[model samples]
Every structure is written in structure tokens, then in C-alpha cells.
Target: MPLPTQEKAAGMTTRGGSTSKPEKRQSGCGGEVKDRRTVEDRLDELLSSMLTRDYLDRQIKQLKMDIHAENKEITERLEGRIYELETDNEDLRKTVGSLEKEIESLHAARDKTEIKLNDLEQHGRKDSLRIIGLEDKSENESVEECVEKIVRFVTDKLEVSLNKNDINIAHRLGNFTRTKPRNIIVKFTSRRKKHDIIRARKKLRGSGQVIFEDLTRNNQQILKDAFRLKCVKNTYSIDGKLFAVLTNGKKRRLFMDTPLSEEYLMNDGNFRRL
Candidate 1:
């Protein structure tokens, strides 16, 4: 009976020891699982930081590209505006050139017309003469008869014969009034006959009657001014020009186009530089 009891006790002790070993192994497994969980959390944090940095870098690069595109667009617009202004400036230059040429052509045309009008006026009064200080005609006598009588008197005084056909037209210049009898204007058939009458006018020096070449209104004014000078002996108009005979027997020619002022007359009509 004693041997059996001892065997039973030994069996109990062996069973207790096995139970303690299994408890220790379970604690060590719990500690290993906690450490694995800590390592996984750290890995997760690192991945999140890398994703945020990549996103920020992409945004910065995109911003730089947008700025470059905007700058390029502004430059193109400025260049286009400059080209437009240059084109407008060139067109204005051409317009100014055309206007200047037109003004020059107008000036040339005006000068040519003035010269032509002067020639026509001078040719119209070629064969006419003016007779001053003639006696008044009688009331019963016709104007033609009065003119014939004057012509006969002139021919007798000059000792030169003149035909009736030589005279084309003769008449008083203005109305025949009781107070003032107008001078006579005569047109001759030929220029030679008119010149002959002018040459013969010297024969009637003492006579009250005076004869002159028919002058334009402008020439008449010039002659009247010239005759006012003390040095001027005689003044005559021929072919639209005035001839002044000085008391010293020198001849001076004057044009109707040039006006004679008081200063010029005071200088004895010496308009030349000499």
C-alpha cells in the first residue's frame, strides 16, 4: 500500500510543472504582437508624409508654367500694337506728299493765266488816238462832219494829205455838255496813219489842241504822275508803254505793271540800281 501512494504523488507533481510552462509561452507571444503593431503605425506615418510632399511639388510646377504662358501672351499683344502704329505713320506720310504736289501745280496754273490776260488787254487798243482841247461842235453839225472838219484842219496845219477812208471811227469820249465839252477818241484803219498823226502833232505846238496815243486807264495814271515831275519835259504812251523825255533830252521807259510811288517820282523815276 505505501508504494502505491508514493507513485500517485509523483504523478501529481509532474502534471503541475507542465501547466506552468504553457502559461509562460502565452505571455511571450502577447509581447511580440504589441511590437509588430508599433512598427506598422510608423510605416503608415512615413507614407502619408511622402504623398503630401509630392502633391505640393506638382502644384508649384504647374504655377510656373501658367506664369510663363501669360507672359508670352502679353508680349505678343504689345508687338501687334506696335506694328499697327507704324503702318498708320507710313500712310500719313504718303498723304502729306500728295497734298504738297497739288499745291505746287495750282501756283503754276495761276501764274500762266495772269500773263495771258495782260496780253489780250494790250492788243485791244492798238490803233486808237485821243484828241484834247478841241472846240465844241455846232448843234446842227453831225458828229461825223465835226470829225472831218478837225481832220481837214490837222492836215492843213501839218502840210500832209489824209484821206477820209483812213479814219475808221471818231467820237467824243463822254456827253457833250454846255459847260464842258468832252475830248475826242479816234480809231484809224491802219497803225501807220495813227503814227503819222502823232508825228504831225509837233507842228501844232502853239495851237491849243493837243493829241496823244490812246492809253489804258492804268497807263494814263502813270503818265499823269510822270508829267508832275519838274525834270520831265514830255510824256507819251505808245504800245501800252510810257516814254518820258527828260529836260536833259534823255529818254525813260516805264511799264504799266510797275506802280510809281511818290518816292520813285522824287528820284526822277530812276528805279534802276545805278
Candidate 2:
């Protein structure tokens, strides 16, 4: 049966060898109707099959196109997200680096401060420094003493207008030697005055400060204390020479010692305040 069916299909070929069939008409009308019905059924089946196949192919192509479009959108979104994450990571790294640098600077400053503090503490005092009491010839330090000490120190001396506020009588030197100041510097708001300049001359009479003195006529030359007195209105030099004196009724005369040049003046600045 299969061979016969195959032969029938081969016989449908036309003279050009393409698949085609031709119909023959019978003399009877009924026989012709039956043959025509069979041909119509075959044609219907071929047309239905072609239509179904076309519809299925078009649906598959549409499904493939939709999948491709969705995949493209997803890939673009992921790429954008990755770019944002990379930028954020870079910013965090920079911030961390800056913080580390600041911490290092603070540590360096702290180390320098510690070294300076140690140096200062090392030079504060010596082991030989000690505290001791002073008597008649006190040590070189100011200390409290009784009124009897002040009275004994000023024996036979006519104390002038003694401003208690200005009087600073104190004992110094342990017992080896005692030094008393003669000339006193009196400071006022408007002017300055030197007191006991003559007194210092009296005190220096037996000391090394005076060169000569005549006790009978009270004619004498006195050494003014440069450490405690200023020769603003007086005419005296460090050489113990009094050039000009304030006469009772005459104007005081001043003579300028030869002026020293700026370079020759010994500008080591150690004796600048002196």
C-alpha cells in the first residue's frame, strides 16, 4: 500500500517535472461530482496546515524580540550602578588617607614639646644651693630684722625725713662682711633727686671711694654712687671728679667731657644699663 501511495504522488508530476495534477471529466454527472469532492477536501487540508504554521512562526519571532529588549535594559541598569559604586569607593579612600596624615602631624608636635620640657627641667637648680641665717654681717640676701638692728646701724647719724614707705632697711650677708648704702635714690612722679651724696662722701672718707678730704674747713670731694644715683643735675664722672657744683647764688656750670665715638664707647651692651 505504501508503494502504491508513493507511486500516486510521483504520477502527480506534470510534463515539467514539478508537483501538479490535472482532472478528467466523466460522461456521467454523478461520477464527476464525487471526484470533484475528493479534490476539494485535499486542497482544504493543505491550506489549513499552511495558515497554522505561519501563525506559530510569527509568535516565536515576537517572543525572541521581547526577550532581547528586556536583557538590554537590565545590562544598562547594572552598568550604571557599578559606576556609582566605584566613585564612592574612591572618595572613601581619599578621606582615610587625609585622616592618617593629620594624626602623624599631631604625634610629631607632641614629641617636640616633650623634649623641650625635659630640657627646661634639667637646668632649674644646682645641688650646692642652700638656705642659711644671717647675723651682723649678713649674707647677700634680704631678710627681716628687729628695730634694734636699725638703731645700731644708724648710730650718731642724723636720719633725714624718713619716709617709712621708701625706707627698706634689711640685713644681708651671713657674718663675713656688712655693706651699708650711703646715697639713696628718691623717685617722684614729676622729678628725681639724689639724697645722701654728701653722706656717701662721709662714708667713703676712710674707704677707697675718696682720694682727699680736709676735715677743718669741711672742703671735701665725694664719690657719688652710680649704682643707686643718677647724675642728671650734677656734674660728676665715674673717675671720682666733680667738675661743676651748684653754687649758692650762681647758675650751675656744666663741662662736657670729650664725647666718645659710637664704636669706641664699648657697646658690648653688658654695661649698657650700668
Candidate 3:
């Protein structure tokens, strides 16, 4: 007998095959289904990876924006603070300038007032003289009587005549002390009488008696310093100007407002140089 051919539904036959055709078709279909599922899974993974990348990109962009905003805010705050500080500094400068101007005005006013005060003081003391070496009287004797007796004695010693009415006022300068007698201050009615008394002052030079012009405290200190200088002699002040009689007999004018220094005292020509 001849080999039999097996026929299937689509008119296909297999000769001496162990598997049926239907089974082969089933296997091919199963393989196609598996390949399709693998392709779908790979496509899903690709889509997920792309979505994740997009999300990461968005997050990174947002973070960058936040950083930029914070930086901008900080910069604006710093700038504002700087501006405020600059404004404050400008106002402070203006205030300082105003204060400086005010201080200068006050200084000028003070200087003018001081000059006026000094002038008044000088005028008030113009007709005054100071007499030294007069002994303090006992409590029983009146001060006025003591002054009159001393004045009479001074006039007699100088061989000059002075009227009792010439002295407007006479008194000791301070309280009496046991150690030393206070100097007598005399105010004359007429400037002529004062000049006469001063002219006659040389008569009492070696007699331990002294007559001095009633100068201001400042001028008195200047006179004392001038007398203390080694090279100076016959130191005197006239009209607030200090004068010194040099050892060489030359008269030199000194700066009354400034203190006498060793440099000024040592060199006789220093005043001239000034």
C-alpha cells in the first residue's frame, strides 16, 4: 500500500510528521503573542523613562528658579540697606557741618565778649595803684586813718605835696594775716595824682617799700615773670604793653599775651626778631 496523506481544514497535509498542523499554528501564535508582549513592555519602559526624565527636568528648572529668586531677593535687600546707610551718612554729614558752623559762630561771639570784658576791666582799674610794705595797723586804729598817715609819710619822703581829697579811696587788698601785711590799694580822683605818686616811687626803691600800677591779674603775672628773668631789668607795663629794660640799657617791648620762655629771655634780640 502507498503512504497516506493527512489532510487538514485548509487543505494542507503532512506526510510522516509527528506534530499536527494545528499544533504548529498554535505554537507560532504563542510565539507571536510573547514577542508582542515583550515589545509592549519595552515601549512602556521607554515611556516611563522619558516621563521620569521630563519630571526631573521640571524639578531642576523649578529649583533653579527658586535659587534665582532667593538670590535676587537677597541682592535687593542688600541694595536697599546700602541705600539707607548712604542716606543716613549724608544726613550725618550735613548735621556735622551745621554743628561745625554753629560752633564757629559761638567761638567768635565768645571771643568778642572776652575782649569787651577785658576792656571794661582795664578801664575800671585805670586810676589805681598798689602800695607794698605798709604795716598792718592795730584794731583800735581805723583803716582810713592808717592809710592817710601812710600817704602823708610817702609824700613827705618823696618831697611831693598831695591833697587829702586827691585819694578817692584807699584800703588794704585782703584780710590781715600775722605772717605778712596785705598790700594797700589806692584809687585816685585825678590821673595826675597817680602819675605823681608813681614818679616818686623810685625814692622808696631801696627802703623796702614798693609802688606798682594796679594791673589786671594777667598783666601782673607778666610783670612778675619779666622781673624774674635774668637778663631783664626795670620791667614795666604801659597801656597793656609789656616793656623790659635790658642789661645793656636798651628798652625792648614784649608780647604781653604770651608767656616768657627761656628762648625769649636768653636772647635779648628775640623780641626784635618777632
Candidate 4:
């Protein structure tokens, strides 16, 4: 009996039961279909947004790796360039120092050469001056010394003191006047026509390392004096007493008065008593 009743409720084909159940069921189906369509649409929108976000994230990670690699390469290149520059700078510094040393050495050599040249030039000038002095002088002595020696020799040998200035001035004259303007005189004597009269006159006129005039007188007294002093090993005696006698041939005769001797005179290499 209960089974029959349950079946009758499930089927509900009676007019009253069937009518109430169908109305209620129709209302719930309509509302459920609308809600199910809305939920499906929202799930589809969420899935589309998630796929786009994942793609963008992958691209961002790849870009970051590329940027990191590029920065590393740039840093390495700059470091290498800096290293090369430093090496070049060191080499340049060494070259500059070597060049400076070479320049300094060159300057030192130049200075040494200049000093040596100056010393040689100084010595050469001194030698040239000495040679010139020899050329310009007759006696080895200085001018004043020669003058004093000759003057004293003549005075002592010939018993006469000559005026120093007068002789000095006269000796410098190149030619003579009828009256000599200067008062100095040279007197020479030779009994020998064998005497090179021209030669003797030449020597006598200008043996003083100076120019002179030939204002000469050839005479008896001048000839006698030189003969007494010139002849070696001769008895130049007057009145049985020897006067000034010549002993050596090398000795030079100095006489203020030529013909100062009254002894024999040399003629044709023979002594003839006059």
C-alpha cells in the first residue's frame, strides 16, 4: 500500500498534483540557466587575462638578460683600452728620459770642445807674438837695453861718452842732409882698402835695429884706432910701451873714436906701421 502511494506521488499525474509541481519546476529551471551562463562567461574572461600576463613576464626576463650581457662587454672593452693607454704612457716616459740624457751629453761635449779650442787659440796667439818680436828686433835685448849696452861699450872702449838721445834720434833718420838735423855721429876707420868699405858703412849706418843716415867721414885718425884693437897677437906699442893690444879674434872692438890707435894698421892682410 505505501509503495503504491510513493509511486502515485512521484508520477503525480492527477490533475491537482500535476498542475502544482509543473509550475514550480518551470520557475527554477529558468533561473538556473541564466545563472549558469553568467558564471561561464566570467571564467572565460579570467583565463584570457592570465595568459596575457604570462607572456609579458617571459619577454621582460629575456630583455633583462640581454641588457646584463651588453653592459659586461662594454666594461671589458673600456678596461682593455685603459690598460693599453697606461702601457703607452710608460714607454713614452722612458723615451723622453733617454732623449734628455742624450741632449745633456751633447751639450757637455760641446762645452769641452769649446774650452779646448779656446786654450789652443790662446797659446797660438802667444807664439805668433813671440815670432813677431824676433822679426822686429836686431839685438836679442829690448830696445832700451840694447841702447844702453852699445852706448856704454863705446864709451868705455873709446874714452868718450856720447849723448844718448842724440844718438838714438840720429839712428832713426833714413837719409842725411848737408847738415844733419840730429847730432849723433858714427866714425869708422880702416887702413885696409881691403876693408869692404861699402859693407862696413852699411853695417855702421844702421846696425841698431833702427833706420839711419850715412853721414860718414873717411880719415887718417879713424883708421888707426880700429887697427890697434882688431889685430890679434900684435904689439900695439907706442914709445916702447904696449898700448891697447888685441888678443882674441872673436872679441868685438868698441870704440867711440875710430882710429883711436896710433899703432900699425891692417892693409892687404899685412900690418904696416904708419
Candidate 5:
């Protein structure tokens, strides 16, 4: 079964003695080495790409954390400032409330003091009298001269017994003016003597002479305001208590704080009707 040399070169014989073509064979191992180099190069490229992508992902995650931290810090700072402002505003409101209460207390205290002072002033003037339409010829008149004039006038014109000793002090109220004669203020040693003179004031009513009780400035203004009303026929004060005689023959007791209005003055219930 040995084949000829030409046929052996063209084909091969198997165990069954059948003719078959031979598999092709490479001349060297260069092709296999080249294919292995190509596979290593592709793996190197894929690993480098994966590493770069991982680095970028880490950088992005860190940047997001940084931004979140910065925003949290800013929000905390703003919230703290708002809380401080709210606390300050509440404190200011409390301070204003305290100030308003203090002001009201001060006003009440002042009103009480004014009332006490007015009462004291009226008490001091209980024995004093004001003589209007009295003649004052000289500005250099002495207090004793004024006292003598008051005594003579009370004795002669008023028909009342008055002595120089009964009058404690007498003086003109203001500077001498050529336009009119100033009134004289006389203080008596006793209220009895002042009352006696006042009781006799009506005798000189037609003689162009008048006498009035010494009143506080506030009471005086109240009397003046009462006189200005047409409904008030006559106004007078006895012991610093003011009285208004209305046109209907009724008398109304008035006070320093009474309203000087027609409606208030004309109220019938307030008057002692004739």
C-alpha cells in the first residue's frame, strides 16, 4: 500500500486507504503572535476609558456635595439674622408700651398736683378782696397810703366800719397806666371783716364802685367766660365757688373745668329753677 512519490505529494491516504486533501499550514508563528498583540491593545484602550469615566464621576459627585454645603451655610446664616430681627422688633414693641404707660402716669400725677395747688391758692386768698374803679393818682403812693384809702372808702362810701388795723396789707395790682386806674388788692386780718365789707358792696353798686372776692386766676377766667354768655344774666363767686344766674331766674353752680358752651350752660336739670 505504499503510494508513489508524485501521488503522495498531491494527496494523503487515511487508515482506510482513501485519498484526502491536507489541511493548510502556516510557514511561521508570526500571524498568531500578531493576533495576540491586537487583543491586548483593545483591552488596554477599554481599561483606560473606564478609569477616565470613573474619575469624572467622582469629581461631579464632590462638586455637588460642595454646592449643597455652601447652600446650607447661607440658609442658616439668613435664618439666624431673621430671628434676631424678630426678637428686636418684639423688644421695641414692649419698650413702646412701657413708655405709653409711663406717660399716662405722669399726666395723672400732674393733674393731681394742679388740683392741690389750686386748692391751696384759694385757701390763702380767703380773707382778701379786690376793689375796682378805685382812683390811684400817684405811682409813688406808699402801702400805708393805699391802706388809708381803703379804710376811708369802706367807712364813707360802703357805710361799713373799717380801720387801718383791720386791713393787713393793701397795694395796687399793676403799673400805673394813663388809660385807666388800676384796681387795689386788700388783705384783711380776719375773714369776718372781709365778709362784712362784701355784704355792704351793694350800697356802692350805683356809685360806680365794685368789690369782688379775691379768686384764683383759673376761677377768674371761669367767671369771665360765664359772663360772656347771653343766657347768663349775672355771674358771681362766693368763697371761690362760682354761680351763674341765668335769664330764667335760675342759678347754676359752675366749676373750673365746666364746659363754656351754650348747650352745657342751658341744661335745665343743672340749674336750680326759680
Candidate 6:
């Protein structure tokens, strides 16, 4: 037997009488190039992520600053409004105080005026007399006849020396009615004559006749109220001044403003018990 010689390539190998191709070897420079490219790509990605995070941080900072400024403006506006409301409330309190003082002043002025008016009214009726229980004989009586009748009645009933000349005016007090006789009002020329008639009125006590001092309307009301009190035994008025004689032997001088009560009567120092 004779064997022929065979030529083999660089990566070819012969094993057990068979020939096989070996794997090709990679170059060392190519592996280094691939590793450098991967490192560059990772660095680029890191840089991009850093840039995006920095942009987001700047936008958030700007938004926070804007929100802070807006909140500050709103707080300042609220503070200003609170200050304005406080100022207005203070002004309103002052106005209310001023109005209350003004009302008090008005009330004081009105009370003084009323006192003066009541005094003047009483002064006007000082020389007048009111005769009650007198018969109304005729509704058509003339002024002269009325005067003569009053003069005669005063002379006979009260036993006073009154003439028609002493009477300045004489007339019935109210509108004439058929149910009862109206009272006669007589204004005398002098207070002395009027007082004399009043003093003599005690004689006609049981004769179904009454004579009053022609008191002011307020005094008359006071007398009426005084008579209604359980503590009062008698009530009368002299020259527009009211007097109440209590059951406890005390004489109380009353005015239009006097409080009509048992406590006031018993405790008043002005009215001494007899």
C-alpha cells in the first residue's frame, strides 16, 4: 500500500482519518472597539437623563415661586379687608353713641317744656270756679241771664256776696244734654271772691251741690287718681294744687308727676303724718 500526501489550510485539522474545519478566531482590536462603543452609549444616556432632571427641577422652582407670590398677594388683600371692616365698625359705634346722647338731650328738653306748659295752664285757671249739680233750667238762656243766675245762686247757696259785676265770664262747661245738667264755669274778677266762694262750699255738702277750684286738667286728673287709692281717705285741690288726706292721718301734696302708690305715700318725707 502507498499513501498520497494532502495539503491542509490554516484552520484545517485531521483527526482519526477525517478532516474538519476549526472555528475562526475573533480579532482583539474588534472586541475593544465594541466595548468602547457600549460605554459611550451609556454615558450619552446618563447625560440625557441628567439634563431632563435639571429641566424639571427648574420648572418646579419657578412654579413654586409663582404660587408663593400669589398667596402673598391674597393674604395681603385679606388683611386689608379686615382692617377696613374694623375701621367701619369703630365708626359705626361712634355714630350709635352720638345718636344715643342726642336722644337723651331731646328727652330732657321735652320734659322742661312740659313743666312750663303745665305751670302756665294752672296760672290761667287760678281765678275760676266750677259749680256742679246746678239745674239746667233752659238751654236757650242768654249770657246775661246765665250771669244773673250764677250770681243769685252763689249769693243764696254759698252765702257769698257775689254780683253779676264780679263775674268776668260765666258759662256751662260742656255741651247741653237732656240726660243731666252741665257744670257751670265762673271766672271771677278777683281771686279773693273766688276763694270765698270755695271756702263757703262746705255749707252745701249735703245739699247735693259741689264747688271745685276750677283746677287745671292735670291737677283734676291727679285728684281723681288720688281719690281712687285705697290708702287715701279724702282728695281735694286748692288753687290747682292737689292734696290727699290718707287714712293714716297723713296729708300728701301731689303734682301731675307724683307717683300714685301706697309705698310712695308712706315713705315720702315731704308728707308728714299728722
How high is each candidate's TM-score? 0.51, 0.27, 0.65, 0.29, 0.64, 0.69
Model 4 CA deviation exceeding 4 Å by range: 1-57, 127-274
Query: Which residue pairs overlap in candidate 3's backbone?
Result: none
- Worst 10-residue lDDT window for candidate 5 reads 25-34
> How much lDDT does candidate 2 score?
0.39
Return the candidate ranking by TM-score, descending.
6, 3, 5, 1, 4, 2
Ranked candidates (lDDT, high to low): 5, 6, 3, 1, 4, 2
Structure candidate 6, residue pairs in collision: none
lDDT by residue (13-100, candidate 1, tens digit) is: 2354342222222345465233555769988988787779778799888999999999999999999998998899899899889999
Query: Candidate 3 or 4, higher TM-score?
Result: 3
lDDT of 2 by residue, 23-91 (tens): 666656556434777879999988788789678899889999999999999999999999999899899
lDDT of 6 by residue, 128-211 (tens): 988888888788877887898888888988789988789999888678887788898889998999889888889997887888
Per-residue lDDT value at 88 in model 6: 100
Across 1-274, the per-residue lDDT of candidate 3 in tens digits comes to: 7554545545566656643433223354465234555779999998888789778899899999999999999999999999999999999999999999999999989877875776678678889888888777554456577668666866787767776688888877777776777788888889887787778888897877788888877667777888787777778865455677767676667653445754566665565642
Q: lDDT at 176 for candidate 2?
A: 44
Candidate 3 yields a Cα-based lDDT of 0.74
Q: What lDDT does each candidate get? A: 0.72, 0.39, 0.74, 0.42, 0.86, 0.84
In the predicted model 4, the residue pairs found to clash are 189-222, 221-259, 222-258, 222-259, 225-259, 225-260, 225-261
Better of 1 and 2 by lDDT: 1
Candidate 5 wrongly placed segments (more than 4 Å): 1-80, 229-233, 246-252, 256-274
Q: Candidate 5 on 36-145: residue-level lDDT in tens?
A: 55769999998888779778899899999999999999999999999999999999999999999999999989988887888789889999999998888988989998
Alpha-carbon shift of residue 108 in model 1 (angstroms): 11
Q: Cα deviation of 271 in candidate 3 (Å)?
A: 9.0
lDDT of 5 at 86: 96
On the 0 to 100 scale, the lDDT of residue 130 in model 1 is 82
Instruction: Name the TM-score of candidate 6.
Output: 0.69
Candidate 6 wrongly placed segments (more than 4 Å):
1-76, 270-274
Instruction: Write one digit per residue (lDDT tens) for candidate 4, span 8-34.
Output: 568654554553333333345465233
- Residue 54 of candidate 4: its Cα lDDT? 75
Clashing pairs in 2: 138-172, 138-173, 138-174, 139-173, 139-174
